[model samples]
Target: MSRIILLIAKFSAFMLFVAQVESNCPSKCDCNPYSWDMNQIDLDCHRAQLDTIPRNVPLTTAKADFSLNKLGLDPGFQLKLDHLHDLRNLDLSANFLESTHIKDIPDSVEILDLSANSLSELSLDDLPTNIRELNLAKNGIDSINGCSGESSIQSSSQIAIRFDYNAIPILTRDTFGNCSASFGYIDLSSNNLHTVEHNAFRGVIQKANDSLVIDMSYNKLEIVPFEAFQDAIFDMRGFEYFSLDLRKNPLLCSCNMSWIPMMLDYFQKMGLKGVIMGTCYGPEESAGRHLEELTKAEFKSCTEYSWLKAEIKARTEQRIMPFWQVCLVVLACPGLVATVVLIVGVRMHVKDYRRYRDYVVRKKRQIATQRRRHHFRASGAVGDVLLNSSIKNSQK
Candidate 1:
């Protein structure tokens, strides 16, 4: 009988300890039992207007929703979540906080929602390896630290990332290169995207399966460089469930875009899914025209309007000279004539001078020859006189 009383006292103490732990839930937060086990709970403190993480959060919580709260970089704010060893989904979105606070988030979390925050960047360390869904939409991020597809975010077998409505201005080459994991969906829509370099989505397409879905609509894109998708298209050639949404973007249509028709044909032959053709909104002639409906004559052999204008200008130049050019030619005619006349006159004068010099030289040569002939005659006469004088003296 004494042993039974001791057992009852011990059970009462254990029950009291559990009751105290349950009562430690944060104030103004709803904590519901997650399972039949009273020790596991789910905390929902969303929009709680709390400036700091509640100190009384139970360590047994499996999912925490502190979204829409005033959680900033306050001291130990993330420490509060780190204590929940079993946390799976953490929603800290709409908090207007930077993502730096969650750089070292618990690896137990699989779904992390940092959307609608003030994050300007996301480093590889900011992502947990086991994460399956990472929502960073509606942030101020201009670029992801390691979006070349080798980052920790893509280390998982399957993950969905929402990066829409960010401040990304461009997608460079190999932005998603060499990724090996399959993504369910990747959203880069509604950003400030202006240029997507060739091979920008290479790594993304390399790892994606047939069920890949990508949204890139509602941006400032003028064109989608087909070279960027060339390899991706080949990789997804036989994929019947591939989908790429590029609607509502202001893509210009011109000769450079002649490959669109070819791309559509390839997609049809491969039985690829999703919207493969979009409407053009530029090149005035092709504007308000769908890529699918554009005939080869209508869309092909098409040049930019600026190029057409230049061609017309060139043709006109070949036909008629501009007023300025005509004036310049008219003004230069007299000068040309005068230059030719001056050159002719100078040549004639130089010819005359040379002729005169040759005449003077010939006259000097003639005079010198005449003087030599006279000297030769006088020397011959003197020699003859000397010979006769010697003969007469000998006779005397």
Candidate 2:
């Protein structure tokens, strides 16, 4: 009988603990078992017409879905989720978040869905560095904030960034400069992209084991800039999965379109996969034609006059210098040589003349000294003869 009472008390204590967990769950949110074991709870408040995150989102929530709601993000609204440190997934998509200047996003969130929002701008401060998959699709974003060489989106893990369906006109190298993260894939398709500047994919491409997929289809692309690949396309040896989707674009077919076949030939030789060579949509005669089908002769006609001009220009560049200029240079060479030779000869003559003048001065001094010595000796001999005559006269 004592054993039965003890068992009854333990059952009552277990019920009290379960009641406390249930009370922690929000009243409006439909909290359900996370799995068959019922060990955790998954809070789902999707389409709940929530103006703000539930004031009491249970700290035990693993995944929170707040999508398809009328939540407007601004500086005034507090979006703090400090309590939910283990929250891995946060879905706030389709919420009329015009401004992405959000704060207090849980650092633990790996997948953040901000798609279908009214976001017009994005910056480093607007997102968390720990985010692995960021969805900014179907927004009014016109430009991406450059990193100014600070940090990249690439962290210890692979990151996938989606920017499809935006008003981006030109994609310069600095567009993704801040995305220091090696990207899994960067979807820029369906944007009003008219120009992709040289090496536009510079910092975004991950140099990891998995290949990077860049989607630029269904846009206003006329030419695939050669510099965009940074010449890495030639050495696609080790990449596990490298693919480029450039279909549905209004590519202008011209002589420059020759590069399309060259790239296709390269992909075939290397056994690389996932290359969709889009067709040409211009030059009236070659519209709706695939880039691979068009031969060199067919492409050259697009710029018929350009060939003649190019040939002439090439011939002109290869041509020798003008006859008069050649003659002038030749003549000037000899004149320069003659001038140098004349200067050297004049210097030698001046040196020799100075030496001769010094020699003549020395010879004149020696001759003058010899005449004085001879005069002295002759006078001394005459004085000796007179002295002898005076002595002989005194003796007589």
Candidate 3:
């Protein structure tokens, strides 16, 4: 009878432990049997018609998978998860979230999967410093906030961020300026990005401290600004090994592409391997020819004149031209004025001399006329006197 009682006691203890584990799970959830070995409860409640997260989650749970659930919690409900201090991994993918549930997340949560949701905009100011892995794929996020100055993510030693298929239109300056991570990768594919500003990846490259990979493919980008990749290498000591995947972009094939040749040469000389995955979107003939397969003849055929290139060259030449052009203009201006003044003075002097000569000629003509008149008067007087004497002698 004693042996039978001991066996019953052992069975009862086991049942009690099982009941305790089951009770720790939410009322509508199921606990995996194998997950108990790690002393953590793994609850799977996917596709459940849950509107809000259940408060009865097991305290010892380290990971929770709630993917594909209809748990469309109100924006206010994100703050409620702060109570779950022990959660390390939380998967809320495919729920079609609209915006951030709350401004802050639990500090203890490390890995967060919010992929395939409807998040349009998010701010990282409220995130805890201990966060490591963050998956935000398929969201409508257009840009990264606080990517410069003091608030940039200078180091992701414990953080990995993924942003794929978000349809981002443009990447502004300092977009990822301070991101620092030993091992980091950014996926900016299948978006509407047409331009990447200078310093767009400053934080990420700086934080990488020598290890980083950036996947920027399947976008509408026509040009990658030189400054965007200026200091973005793994290290400045030498050509650091880094990966850049630029595929499916509409590369404009023109003389403006001189920059492309220069950039490729720079990367090759630095011992870096960068891949250009797609062909050029040139004029009609070579619209979709791959860049790698293109020969020099084909490239020359596709190349066209670029006004921007001409303008740049013109401006550069103007900047470097000697100051003598300006100095010559300045020096010639006074000479031109002096020549005009001398010509005017000579004309005035000639007019004055002509007037004086005319006055002297008129005076001489007047004197000669007066002298003839006087001579005629004197002759007439003598004739009158001779006539009077002759008349008197005739009368006598």
Candidate 4:
């Protein structure tokens, strides 16, 4: 009898534990009925008849899968998610959310799957600092602006930003301005972007280090601003693995596309490895031909408006001026005058030598006259000596 009583007490304790876990569910929603674990509770409110999100979700929950629900992100639903501080991953995909829902995302959330929504203009400030991966594919976002807030992403990590299949008309200047220097990978493909604004990615390239990779493919971009990439290549003191995929754009092959050939030639000579695929669209005749398939004449026709070719020709001509053509007149006049002067100087020297010879003959005749006067003086002295000797002989 006592053993039966002990068994009943153990069964009551187990039932109380299970009831306590079930009572911890958020108000007005069904938690996991099978498992009493709070973190692992799959709160699947898919297609639920509830109009507003339950505010009292478990704080320990990691994943909130809220897909295929008719939950419109009106003002009431936006207020409910304000208190979900522990949510790491939230999937609100396939829901027809308006632009206001993008503005209401909590900063604590990391991974948000808002793909297949009706978002037209998504501000970068709507993304939280902790967010590492975002899915805004198939949306109506035309441009990407950096988050403008005092609080920045604290995590020292790379965020994989994916924006695919959106009809972006233009990439605005300083698009990723508020991105931290630590961000690394970005994927922007299948958009309708026509012109990339100057300094569109200046901030991102300045902040990102060597591990950065940007994928921009399948856009309708006709012109890439050379100034936009000049700073990224020269000013930013970082090794960038920038791969530009400019394929499938209907490039206007008129004089406007002169920059294309110049950029291609520069990259080819420098051995730069990147995608440069496009077909000419304008100028009447070569409307639908790829750049690679065009002949030399077709390429030259495109160079009619090329400022680079004209500048190159001007520089080359300036470097090789003909030496004889420039100095011929200066040399001819002076050379003839110098030859006449040299001939006159040689003739004058010969005449001066003959005059010097005649002057030496006159000087020799004057010296002979002086020598004859000295000889007469010596003979008078000798005759005086002989008369004195004869007077001495007579005295003896």
Candidate 5:
């Protein structure tokens, strides 16, 4: 019957797929086909000390784990693996890779782990077009703009890029420039971050679709980039999805950060998931205080420059000199500079005057010399006229 023939055909196809999976897998790797979809396979080759990628992987491999190995450190490391047309997941962590090593990952890769390596550059153009989950933790990343180039290539997929435990110094407004829509989940924890400029999250939050959870904990951040998250300066409304974690930072929650409490209160009322925690690092009395614990009346004297004043005060207090003494030096510095400038100006004027005086002396001496010569010439002309008169008298 027709139904019997169809069943036989299905059985034959299943057997052929099983044979392919059994014969094509590398000897060191454990390869198996999915129970539901027999054609798709998973290859686990981790901890195998693989210096070279095995060319014997199944053509239907959907996931491959080649982590914990000193794989070939070439930009074209995976170029010849085109047989894995359905390869989606790849883990190459702990391979000590740089940006060049991952420049040519397969376009089919959706999840990639290049963590625990030595990557420094943060360009996303090296990523696969379909990358959704990218892990770059424990690297030496010192720059950003990862989402700034060809960023629309991953627009179809939500992003979860991790840059934890790096040496990233600062975050500017253009850090995530041109990021795709619905892009979210950036981890910047445990970095050498010193500052986050205002509107720093504008690039990543411009096209936020649902939730934007940023982990900026464990840095030297003195203040949050509040404008990009709460203020009307960027029209950042709909606060149900914006979650910022600022714990463990040496935050200077002073007057300028008076706006921090207001932002927390607004986000809380507007469906905040959890508490947005920020602790103070200075101002003597507020050193161990939390931003939420501050009374509203405490900020009566707070201004836009209050945090700056606190920073300056804190910096000056740390020096060997007293605050007033440092202020004296700072205030008297300009006067010292002015005195030097004045002295230099007086010396220049004195030098110019002396040069002019010498020139005048030389001119006077030249004039005296010319007057003597003119008197002598006049005397000589008189003598010549007298001689001519005497000659005429003698001739007469």
Candidate 6:
């Protein structure tokens, strides 16, 4: 009888205390106590036709889904989520938010989604300290706010950032200079990215400190800027599971893409642990082919010209290269033949001069021999005639 009385009193306290907690919930939002976390609530105000966030949400809200709303249309809609100490994940995607001047988001919120909006500029000053993953896809963002040294963004841990499907046309070295996060995952895919200048990710790609994954797929790149990624490849070589996805880019696959094969070979030699996906999409012969799988004959045209005439002929072969080499030789042929002919003529003249000198010496020796023979014959005849005259006088 005493135990039953005690149980009735405890039940009445629970009904009055715990059950009345739902009475303060917003009319448009559903408030449910999360089973995983004690006393924490999950607020679902998504697609509730709300022009602003409900102010009556419980302070113990752990997760909030405020997506698909008209929050940006209201000028007086001031977002203040720092009061919710237990908030972690917040989905504000598709809200048509334009500015990132939000200053009240708490550090407790880690995953923030601002995708499918009209955000033209993103500032690092708007993010939370404990944020791990931030989605800014399809925002048509033209520039980053903190990159001009207006402010600095510091994060306690490595963050994964997504800026995919935006209006970014070029990436310079100072693109992400304001964000001091050692970001492990960066998705810059699906944009008007035509060029990534050298050292574009200078601060972003840490030096052998952490693993990284970069997605630059589906862009308007005609050349694979090898100079821009030299440091990135060196930094990623020590990592275990990194990836550089350049697939679906409209690469020219000409000498312009000559760095593709060299990068693959170096990636093999360095023992870098990752997969690189790149393919050519134009010039007909190299379309739909992997960058590393192309033959030396395909890249043979790169060696054909003197680096200046590379654009003379598209996909010229080794046969064409030799023709230019032969032309160079033909241009030098007259001077080479003249030099050789002059040397040969000089040698022949020297040989004829030596033969003439030997002939003159032989003619002098022959003339002296004929004179000695003539004098000896004349003396012999005179001696015989005198001997006959003396013998006739002695006989008389």
Query: Which predicted model would earn the best lDDT?
Result: 6
lDDT of each candidate versus the true structure: 0.72, 0.70, 0.64, 0.63, 0.72, 0.72
Residue 264, candidate 4: Cα error in Å is: 7.5
Residue 354's C-alpha lDDT in candidate 5? 100
Q: Which candidate is the best by TM-score?
A: 5
Error of 4 at 227 (Å): 2.7
Candidate 5 ranges beyond 4 A from true positions: 1-15, 73-83, 148-150, 206-209, 228-236, 269-274, 305-396
Model 4 segments more than 4 A misplaced:
1-43, 47-50, 73-76, 149-151, 181-183, 206-208, 212-216, 233-240, 253-396
Local accuracy of candidate 5 as per-residue lDDT tens digits, 327-386: 999999999999999999999999999999999987876676555555555668875675
Off by over 4 Å in 1: 1-22, 36-39, 73-80, 147-150, 153-157, 178-180, 205-208, 295-396
Better of 3 and 4 by lDDT: 3
Residue 280, candidate 3: how far off, in angstroms? 1.4
C-alpha RMSD of candidate 5: 21.4
Error at 201, model 3, angstroms: 1.0
- lDDT per residue (tens digit) for residues 221-281 in model 4: 6656555554554333334344555557666665555555555554443344333456766
Task: Provide TM-scores for the models.
Answer: 0.64, 0.64, 0.61, 0.56, 0.68, 0.65
Please state every model's RMSD to the true fold in angstroms: 24.9, 19.5, 27.2, 22.3, 21.4, 25.5
Clash totals for all models, in order? Answer: 1, 5, 12, 0, 0, 0
Q: Give the TM-score of candidate 4.
A: 0.56
**What is candidate 6's lDDT per residue for 108-170, written digit by digit as tens?**
888888898778877776777678889999987876644455444455566798999998888
Estimate, for each residue in 1-396, the C-alpha lDDT of model 2 and write its tens digit. Answer: 999998898777656645665778776678765543334557888978787877888777778888998777544565667788778788889887765334567777788888998888777545666778888899898877756666624366767889899888888775655456666678988999898887677666545355777888889999876557643443344457766777899898766565555455445544566364678888788899876676545544445335433433443444446668989999999999999999999999999999999999878766765555555556687755754554454445
How do the residues 219-290 of candidate 3 rate in per-residue lDDT, one tens digit apiece? 897767646655665243243455666678887655444344444444454455654455678756667866
Model 6, poorest ten-residue lDDT window? Answer: 310-319
Candidate 1, poorest ten consecutive residues by summed lDDT: 303-312
